[model samples]
Target: MTSPFDPTPLPPPECPAHASGGAPEPEVSEIGPGGLRRLYGPAHEKDPMGLYEKLRAEHGPVAPVLLNGDVPAWLVLGHSENLHMTRTPSLYSRDSRRWRMLQDGSLDMTNPLAPIFAYQPVCVFADGAEHERQRGAVTDSIARIDHRGVRRFINRFSNRLVNDFCESGQADLVSQFAEHLPMMVMCQIIGMPEEYDEELVQAAREMLKGSEKAIAANEHVMGALYRLVARRRAEPEEDFATWLVEHPAQFTDDEAAHHLRLVLIAAYETTANLIANVLRMVLTDPRFRAQLSGGHMTLPEAVEQTLWDEPPFTTILGRWAAGDSELGGQKIKAGDALIVGIAPANVDPVVRPEPSASMQGNRAHLAFSGGPHECPGQDIGRAIADTGVDALLMRLPDIQLSVEEDELRWRSTLMSRHLIELPVSFAPRPPQEITGPVIPERAGAAARDWQISSPRRPDPAASGTVPQPGPVPAAPRTAPPAATVPAQRRGSAPVRAWRTLVTWWRGY
Candidate 1:
């Protein structure tokens, strides 16, 4: 078997600038163990976030870790700093050379898990207006998309899988339940035919498994897709392939293939890990499993907690500064690579509920990227997970972990974080066909509550004559300091102010 190593360089993560110049270690805190060592096989493969916390308690909260001498990166542990860094557009940037390297095709895909670079460049790699258009194409309905559509799709898919597994009394949740779910759904969403499903899924596995052979297979699929985009241009259909064919002026076939492949992997890879990670979360939290079984928590609620507690896409790769700049209290030079341990930031008590309670069931975090670059396909993911979990649980409420949770294995890949397999068994259920729309799971506006809200005033007891409670007033917003405001011309502010007043007056 190949050695377990990230395909990219593994520089000991940089500690904060405060710890720069061979300074003594800083502080770290301890949360419960995540069983990382036993799963990954090596101590170094253990989660840096966990180690960082240990280091922080031993040192100071603002810890510094030196890797490669000059690499100065710090752990932003507090909620305030994590939020400050994540939302900072001016100081911090999200760019990564890793994607560029992937497409460069220098690596040998001969290793089953080796990654072959792009079939072409995915559009997220592009910045500015071009990215907007590329992203906008699928985002058509975009934010307005009925997340319900996603739920329905997952419900259908999950039922099919559960019906197969629930009866077997045993199934490898990773391969049978989790991994296959995303790949098949990805194929459908990307408009690829079943003809390529098995091979594409197999290829996807290698990339995540980080096997050279799997990597090569993925490259083959990507290459075929590049060619297919051109061929499809001559013959259009109702899928993404046809969409690219029709929008010849907006993107070339090669570009479309490249972009689509990115979208597919983005959809598939994150999810493969998400399913595994969520399962791990459920297994670890007896209360959480009880919540699911007892219906105290709906699928949506459970997903929210898992997303915050242990999102699979722990770190997102981005380039520092597009070049480099001072960010998160560190002076980052241009051309530096950054691995934003985004998931860890999500779990910090500040951003999330105290990790302990949230571990029971709390706020959802941004496994998806935040702000402008946020995953446009989040609705699809939400829909898939909610539907899948709901259907599976409903079908087999008694399902239990076949292997001890600690004994389960985990592996990371070029694109995602995940488990090796999840074996589960339950009393069989009769196969049932899933048809029609799946109900939507409610996810709050952007996955977190930035401010507190008053309880919904309950409707007066239904006297049969009582009308429904009147619409409550919207919550007050946090106002910015006035001094920072630009001076407005004498009449302009009054005029605009009057217009706003009039609009509110009319609504009332």
Candidate 2:
């Protein structure tokens, strides 16, 4: 039932101009894209991005490898393949079967009597209109980083966790702090009852660990979410849960519940890893620390750059091609997996030269993925993580890792770059309200959501123009399409009103 030159429609191409620009297509080892089982061990052990970089260095961006020893997977390191994957949904299916493995019966849950379930996704996993609907509500409900609010939450909870383990001073940052932050914030965003925060987090964490025991334990977590979905269905509130309930055009009860799980799961790892990784990276480089600690620089810019250059999504996402195709002139057969190399794609030398450039530019990093299939909740994801960083740095500015940086252990996974644990000495930042310490850095709607940068290239996947690793780009392409700003934006309305009132008072 398969033909090498079958009738499946090929994807629409971007400007093929850049395909001929810089370097010749990299070389690959496997005789054909189908012979990827040979490249499994190193690729699996080193994370997809690391393995992809090696292949790109030797083979090319379109290096084909095998997934889990049998299935063929394409390593789409080149801009064209990356963009093409996003654009052509017909050739790829995001419906991942790996998620179902979480439901294996060997694991047991706190709610042993609970119903068995399936792996669900937010709009990011959806195609066309359904995906769009989920995307719309998701884009709306992302909680912003309010310095005051996040500060309060971090202080109230983190201090307790630290205090509980202070004398010992060796609590796993993954469980104690990094994991707890996102769990708590997600609860807050969803308007879950405060009493259930710990209970809910425990369940969610169970699902997160992805083990047989953890899977079974996740029943409680999924059950609580199920109950909450029903409650919101009856009486919707203003929080994300309520919005999800009201957005009938976007998702159903089942869809919303799955999305809720996806959001929490997605939000949890990235936030934890970003914060913990920044600590590791900074601690590793004392000069960077001196620059940050000595007031020469704030960690935000450094944090943004580090995220761009060395993203936590070392092995974050994977895709399965729906049809046979050619990317960068390389063969890609149907039933092949295509994992996005966010870290490599970000630091491709072609994407951003300095890698440390501030966000004061266009959305440049593949760290968030691109095209319609891009991570819809990244803004919210960044906001939550940024809040944690802001909280940690602002509340515990002088915090130092308890162990030597060299002794720090890193975990090997297909998804992210993370330390096993980050034990630190917590110290609060000196309280001095500087003038405009945190500015939006936006000249327009899309003026770098994470940093302050301008748009330079419309199709960044292939566009040669890029910022020179600075805070802001000198020649960003142009403004993006006009999107209606949400009035419910956390601090946007208050900030505007407060400024206007002050100006009026001054005039009077």
Candidate 3:
């Protein structure tokens, strides 16, 4: 197996000093303690729409602000500027290693943002040919996934989850259903057994909090991937893990582990929030609810609207300046740290004067970052969210929030904007009989040996954060349909990658 970290030559420099062509230096306004508190503190976390609006209106699209009230970074608040920075990767690099704060040891490695900004062996951190290599491998494997099979998997899991609390007449949808459904779908996609679902859920909990426990959480997830890789190598099966192992990239065992870890977590986090946000919209706004049932808005349209208004991810990790540059008339010096403000950029009044009206059918949001480093799993992520939401709506059409809309809470994190819990109530219904073909049991280790010990769990209460629930033990899962794709063809990675992006563009 070849090392997946193979480096590629850098592209010719597209940005140079004085690239702004004598534009006056824009005052880099620091986001003082009040600003930081307002952005990631409790008030902003609850509903960032107002904060983003204030920032964009007061500071223009691109403004400089202190991260955590100390770390200086530029927040790209406009849609056009966000697109310019991300689309021009040569000008703005994704390589976190290039971040001057990390190099100078000013940034603490233990900082909660480390997981996203710190260097990792996977493609998300890589650039140039290396990015293409790892990205191609991921996109090619993703493109091979049968679309209908993915929908079936989501439906089965969604149905299984809904049955868990249907008799209770009330449940916290976020903890009980919205959160766990995506994790189960991701596990099924990666060929993990059903039994380890609890452990993975716990790992996700730790990973999101991002402290000392984050270190333990990382190890826990990697350990599971290692064991899964060994099992697949010993007994190859029809799953993403197997395809990754046999792909032309020939990723080494460790390389395979890292990439699989990335895929699982990315797939789980993005889709989970996507499903939750869409459901929240469906439950909160009677107008939106009527639109859905009246055929005025489709599930995909709902998903699209959520992506624009409340993208799963609010910010992308720091993209450092390779050389001094200017964006939207703001002079960005070399080595300046820039964070893509997804929430603000998506609603920039300049591009989207009326954000709500623009999203009726728009697909031009930066929820998924653009350029060489765009998310490779977006196609299936959308499928998973759409299918899961569709299943819930079809099953529990009368579901409504049990609590007042204002009473719901959102998690406080620098990188994610997730609802902590969405309590909802619905009329009870009798369980349906299992009539589908006898769903086959999963094939993997029988014991719980893969559950690695970790450091002491973080105190969610100490931080005033609510931990999401573990995966509800799913019933026998319906087997997904076989992949409709043929074996890998020559030079197919680029094609597959292109097809996935194009699909995202046209909303096919």
Indicate which candidate wins on lDDT: 3
Q: Which ten-residue region of model 2 has the weakest summed lDDT?
A: 480-489
Worst 10 residues of 1 by lDDT: 480-489
The 0-to-1 C-alpha lDDT of every candidate, in the order given, reads 0.51, 0.53, 0.69
Please give, for residues 114-208, the per-residue lDDT of candidate 3 as tens digits: 66787887788888888887887787667656554456556667778888888888888878887788788778777775425677787887887
Model 3, residue 80: displacement in angstroms?
A: 1.1
| TM-score of each predicted structure versus truth | 0.67, 0.66, 0.79
Tens digits of per-residue lDDT for model 2, 293-325 = 444444455566667756767643466566666
- List the candidate 1 regions with Cα displacement exceeding 4 Å: 1-41, 55-120, 141-146, 244-249, 322-324, 359-364, 412-416, 433-508
Backbone clashes for every candidate come to 40, 23, 0
lDDT measured at residue 449 in model 2 versus the true structure, 0 to 100: 22
Reference-based lDDT, residue 79, model 2: 59
Residue 234's lDDT within candidate 1 is 60
Who is ahead in TM-score, 1 or 3? 3
